[model samples]
Target: MSQILKGGCYCGGTTYTIAIPDKLPQVVGTPHKVPTSILDHCGKCRKTSGSLFQAWIVVPKPWITITYKYKEGSGGKLVEFQSSAHGTRSFCGACGTNLFYDSSKKKAMVEDMDGVVYLVNVTIGSLDEESLTHVELVKPKLHVWWDHGIGWIKEAFTTAGQGFGGLAKYPTGDVRQSPEELI
Candidate 1:
């Protein structure tokens, strides 16, 4: 069955819905494939979110709908920042909350996806807190950029501080999908 996951900025200035297909596409570039989501610890993600790690839900561009509203005499719209040569970031101008990470400039991990489309990743934290109760549903299969991660923070997570679950860790990127699956 399909689902439309709801999320928005902290100030309620921006809102969006993710149309979850019956089968989530391999929208995230892999060696980590079919996660439909991931926990990002890359430097870019850290700087943008001002957090140690950022959780993201990945889906095709066609699957997401974004709306902007004006509030408090402010634009109250999503401001786009070209954070990287291959990626663009969007956040609420009113409250400065990072919401969307656009990877259209980057190439899909699997070359043979059948058609041209880009992945639009959303900040999982922005999703309704109630929807996050089901851990497995939003759990990331891989932790990317581990080498750049802080040690104590990593240990706190890996050594069973509390509510810990083991996920594959990759220092640089992630485990790629099988060669056959690429086509």
Candidate 2:
């Protein structure tokens, strides 16, 4: 079951669609990890997003397309910032919305298929409301760079000897009681 996730920047200046295709055969030699979304807790991500962690919908460069426009009707690509020697972060200049992180440089390549270099780590929060509900559909299977995040973040998300003390979970917007309350 593949999905097309739609997203845009705060001011609607930037829009994109991520087409997640169903799994295919691994024809490339050597080990390769399937392209799945991820929760990145690295310091750079946190600093760039001003969030504790950043949820990324990882997609091959070919599977996504982006469009952006300015206030005066100047449509252009995202403003790319080279945050690291091998990586870059792109955002909408109009509204300052962080969009994607690219790490296609061969020097920093860790997991990629043969001839496949670029992967867009799309900011999940930028996705539309309907796409947000399809969180499970994106298949964000890994939590990476957690060691660089705050200590509590890891504890709350993982078993970590203690049970989940993370963000409280409520089924809906209101803080309504569950199970017995409804019954």
Candidate 3:
């Protein structure tokens, strides 16, 4: 059975629904192969979210529907930013809530043999807290851009016994200093 998940922006300006596949793929060791969710620590994600890491839910683009409203009287609308030549990032223009990341080029390149469009990534933090009871189903399977990750992030995950074995390390050196060490 497919599951319907609801989410919106911080100011309730943008709302979305996502249909999750019943038979989600298992968390695999390969970063590109994992089919559920992933945590990103790349410079762009960190700068966009102002967080050390951002959790994203990966699903087929066709599974999502989004609507935007400016205020009580204003009609629905959406604002999108072309983050890269082939990638677009959407957000609530009114309140600046980072909402989505779409890579049509990536999807096109990965279309199935049957020519079906593939997946897109949405910020997991945008979902309504109450509607996230089944969040475990979308728990991040791996951490990407580990070389750009903050030291405390690594330490926290390590302390929890969920070390960085499944991490995707970029060539950039680890630049983050742990707060504890600084204190």
TM-score, one value per model? 0.75, 0.74, 0.72
Candidate 2 clashes between residue pairs 3 or more apart in a chain or in different chains: none
Clash number for model 3?
0
Candidate 2: residue 4 lDDT (0-100) = 81
Residue-level lDDT of model 3, residues 58-176, one tens digit each, is 77677788876666654435578887788888877777888888887645322232354556888989988765677565678788889899887878787755676445544456637
Mark the 10 consecutive residues where model 1 has the least summed lDDT. Answer: 26-35
lDDT of 2 by residue, 40-65 (tens): 99999999999988988766677687
| Alpha-carbon runs more than 4 Å astray in model 3 | 25-35, 72-76, 108-114, 160-183
Candidate 3 has an lDDT of 0.73
lDDT of 2 at 122: 87
| RMSD to native, candidate 3 | 8.6
Task: Give the top-scoring candidate (TM-score).
Answer: 1
Clashes of 1: 2
lDDT tens readout by residue for model 1, 43-146: 88998999988888776676688887666679779899998777899989898888989975744643335566677778889887766664655777667688
Question: Which residue window of length 10 is worst by lDDT in model 3?
Answer: 26-35
The predicted structure with the larger TM-score, 2 or 3, is: 2
